[model samples]
Target: MMMKAVLVDDEPLALGFLKRQLEKVSSIQVLETFTYFDSSSNISVIKETDIVFMDIEMPERNGFQLAEQLLELNPGLEIIFVTAFNQYAVQAFEVHALDYILKPVQTERLKKTVKRAEERINAKQEAISEKPTKLCINVSGELMFHLTNKDPEIVTWRTLRARELFLYLLHNRDRSINKDVLTELLWAEVDQEKAYAQLYTTIYHIRKTLSNYRDYLTLKSVQGGYKLILSNTIIDLYVWEKKLKNLSTLEGQTIPIAEELMAIYKGGYLQEYGYVWAEAERVRLEQQWVEAAQQLAAYYHDQGNFSSAERWYRELCNKHPDDEISNYQLFKLYALTGKNKLAEKQYQIFKKALEDIGTGVPHTMEKWYMNWKQGIARKTSM
Candidate 1:
């Protein structure tokens, strides 16, 4: 059967735009739309609806409230968030929403996401959901609960277990966790089948709680495992990764876009969370941070801000003493500021450091020494 959909929005144009887009999706059919709240009678139009494309801010009865009542009427209804963005990302992650779309939705993004939704619908039609009735994903430092039932209000982080489970998925947001692994970590060795059942129970309870914001978070099953799908616009950590990739191409003497990028680096991509792959990302970002610092130092040095330039270059050298460029920059910055002795000392240190690491100091350092000698000869003649 084709996936049936209902669009609930307070704006007429927004509803129209979605209806037209769904027309192209091939698999999704719009059952109805509500630009304004009417009667409970409206629910009848979508009695067989598979998914609700819901907007959070609506007239009279808000979408959240409306969704609650509608779910009360039919507990099996699925939801997808369509918000212009109201700090919804975290809540979305916690609630286990299927997917979310932002305002002015791009056609390509919408089409691709709808295709995935269709896949989910087909999979559900065939898969044995005997595993768990609900899915609860921790949104890092918070609990986002979802289940078949519908509740409108948001969830808060209260217990240690809530925090633990939520942070686990948030840290591993990109990767799926195996049920067997979760069972081992959560319940330890217990009876095999019993532990599996207990694991399902935890996920079910978490899901049941998260069902409140079902439109925002989506925990999907695939290949004998499950994965937490997150929105890039909602995740600043992802934004940083994008900026860092482009930053390497920036060579010299431009505005500090890299610095602006670095400024937005908020605590290392869900810093408090931990997972097996988290350290690899941490190391990656740390290296990027160091690289940005080096670039900013060079930019400032060229701008004649000797103090700021030296400050950054010194940090790069101190943190990564073996970096040849950082050492050379330090020496150059010192020389420019009329600290010849300091410059000579840094060059000496660079040579010794490189020798200790079994590599020759690059020819660039030798030029600094040649210039120093030339200047001394000129001074003696004067």
Candidate 2:
């Protein structure tokens, strides 16, 4: 398959040389070349192009910053940073560039880069074509959709209002919402007629955008408002929750299944989107995850699996820094294991966590710490 590429270099000579060399490669098709990014015209082409060959140094905007903007437009777009200096190699990969080639570019090296880009593009295409038709939506970390065999891609909404309206419907999918309720929630500032008109236009845009997934999703006009019906759809949050509910107890055999379920709850529900309406459900789901994690951690602790217990408890503490139970458990585990310094550090952290919330350690916890400290002192004296 022929892969499309775009080149960006401030120097006309270097840009021409790279373009000419790419033309020699049979698989690559140079689509456009830019001396520097013209925010207006270049963005559309960048979105359409498959790969970008860019220089590290430029006058208008450095290649790193421009590459970032381009990747934001098309996350799948492969970036190959070509520069004379080798020091930028580390930073180039940090931004997830495909390859770093130094100038003056060599024929053999350019061929290798082109071959790699072609393989990557072909792999992505094959992945999409290989799988059966299935719709997967992930709202755990962010709003992303995977249709058929394609990789998960974030929906680029036509407008902010369009995005918000779609998410609102999705949050309350399978049920018809009232038009008055939606208008009041989203377009309260506008006049009634204008709000309704804007709503109609936004709905039209959404339907046009989702026309490709007509088999799996349907945005229907109900008696009053609209309903988003999902068919043959696998939502990550739903699958995780359902599996979690089915697991009655965590046993030696069941531990792995429970661990898999924990992994499915990637992050708080719709956490990245920050939709105020999603907050309640997010909190509820988070609490469920915490309860399950607590159960798993307690089981490991009881089974004398200190390493696994510490791993899960630390994960819990990382997710919920002010979780008193996990913090105290870690403290006890470390103290009993004769790691007194780690125990002390954990105790201090627990104290500070509570203090941050305008509280202090509970009397029972304080008493336990004091007793442990006295015991340590006695042992030292002995």
Best candidate, lDDT-wise? 2
Candidate 2, poorest ten consecutive residues by summed lDDT: 35-44
Range of the 10 consecutive residues with the lowest summed lDDT in candidate 1: 135-144
**Residue-level lDDT tens digits of model 2 in 1-382:** 8888999899999999999998899888899888877756677898789999999989968889988888768868999999999999999999999999999999999999889888988888886687558898888888888876688888888998888898888889899999888898789999999999989999999998788888778998989999999877888888889989999778889999999889888899889878788999999999999999899989999999988888888888888878889888888888878889988988888888889999999888899999999999999999
Instruction: Name the top TM-score candidate.
Output: 2
lDDT of 1 at 43: 60
Give the per-residue lDDT digits (tens) of candidate 1, residues 256-321: 677677666645534555544466866676687787888788778777788978888887777677
List TM-score per model, in order: 0.44, 0.63
Give the poorly placed runs of model 1, Cα more than 4 Å off.
Answer: 1-168, 171-176, 184-214, 220-224, 231-233, 246-254, 270-274, 314-324, 338-382
TM-score of 2: 0.63
